[model samples]
Target: MKRRTLMTSALALAVFAAVPALAVADTLDDIKARGTLRAAIDLGSPPFGMQDANMQPTGSEVESAKLLADHLGVKLEIVEVTSPNRIPFLLTNKADVVVASLSISEERKQVIDFADPHGVIQVIAAAPKDVDIKSVEDLKGKDVATTRGTTNDKEATTQAKDANIVRYDDDATLVTALVSGQNNIMISAPQIMNAVNERRTNDPLEVKFVLKVNPYAVGLRKGEDALKAAINDWVKTDLANGKLNAIYKKYNNVDLPAEMPKP
Candidate 1:
């Protein structure tokens, strides 16, 4: 009876020790066995993730996802997502990773794990060149446009307290409102403002002032330490090789930030 009890206790200890290792192996093995890495991304946010004229996904985030897939020796599959849906997709196992321009935040950290930042984005106030806005204070009493439920909208609301904020469903509509004179100002990503300017033949829009600098990273399901470590390794290696900067330049027409955080 004594020998049996001792063997049972030893077996329990071994199982407990293996639990963490098994949890770490699950996601990596599933991804490899499936032979494809499904990357969730927003298909309408230009310069980070968007559908080009051909209606195929293209941009910095898409390229980054492709790089990750290549690194893993797997085929790449893109799953379109909105900002609010990005986390849900991961939680539901609909995507292996989210490569959208998801900003790192304390609230988000509660639900998912973020790899080392792949890039940085600045949220800014943009207006037509002739508009005399020089700062957030200048937006008082002016009509401002930004996508609903986004950091841009929140910042614009907080900083330009007296401004009339027009919330649109997506970046495309927000840009349209600015171009059509429905809004005199827009709070958005700098890359988004540049994308809008590239499409216009008239007076182009320009960033007035930056509201916030956000670090963007790949989102993984919670507790996937092995996958997170692998992604961080890839990001660090790419940063060292100049591959990440090349991808940023291809879509943003600028180099990656000089002070990007190291992995």
Candidate 2:
């Protein structure tokens, strides 16, 4: 009887030890208590997130970040991040979340979680209007430029057979290459191409073709259920009430997407 009771007690203790402990609590609750939600944003890209004349961050993405901070009832802290460092920033806790124009990819899913898709973008190829380029096949053995460390690079590499791919950190360098006749063509987001065209109407480049379409989303650390849930809820509410759509249209001539889909 003594041995049986000892075994039973040991089993009970094992079961008790196995009980799951919820150590990390709700992100929204924690943010509210802390009074600040740090959002890592890409200030290099225009019409999404960029610095103004006074060097203040302002754009559709910035406004969305502000709205999210407000919804969480905390102050908004914006950290300017680049394409290469955005994911790392979130993983290292340098920023609580990311609102960069981060495209959803299977490779990235291994390291971070993404919110619902907020924007749909297409990879468009452009060159001088006088050029006779008509399709992706025409770029064979030619050089193509795109923003470094972006979805555009992924698609460009896959679609452009036997083509030399050059990547720049931002639009300015990519555009400069094409204008200076250093590259045969340039590939980037359609909205960004449109912006470049609008800025230089007199010397505009032509879009030859759209390679592929993808969606952009906010990113958080993987396994952070609390943070992911809070962002998902916030996105759903914003999309349903037309807040998300309005923000995009208000900032640029592009129309807002009808719905925010899961990427």
What is the per-residue lDDT of model 2 for residues 96-175, given as tens digits with 9 covering 90 to 100? 88897788988888887888877666788887687778888888887888888788888888888677888888755665
The TM-score that candidate 2 achieves is 0.84
Cα deviation in Å at residue 149, candidate 2? 0.9
* lDDT of candidate 2 at residue 254, scale 0 to 100: 69
Q: Whole-model Cα lDDT per candidate?
A: 0.84, 0.77
Q: Taking the tens digit of each residue's C-alpha lDDT, what string does model 1 give over 59-110?
A: 8999999999888889899998876678889888889899988878777888
> How much does each candidate deviate from the true structure in C-alpha RMSD?
4.5, 4.9
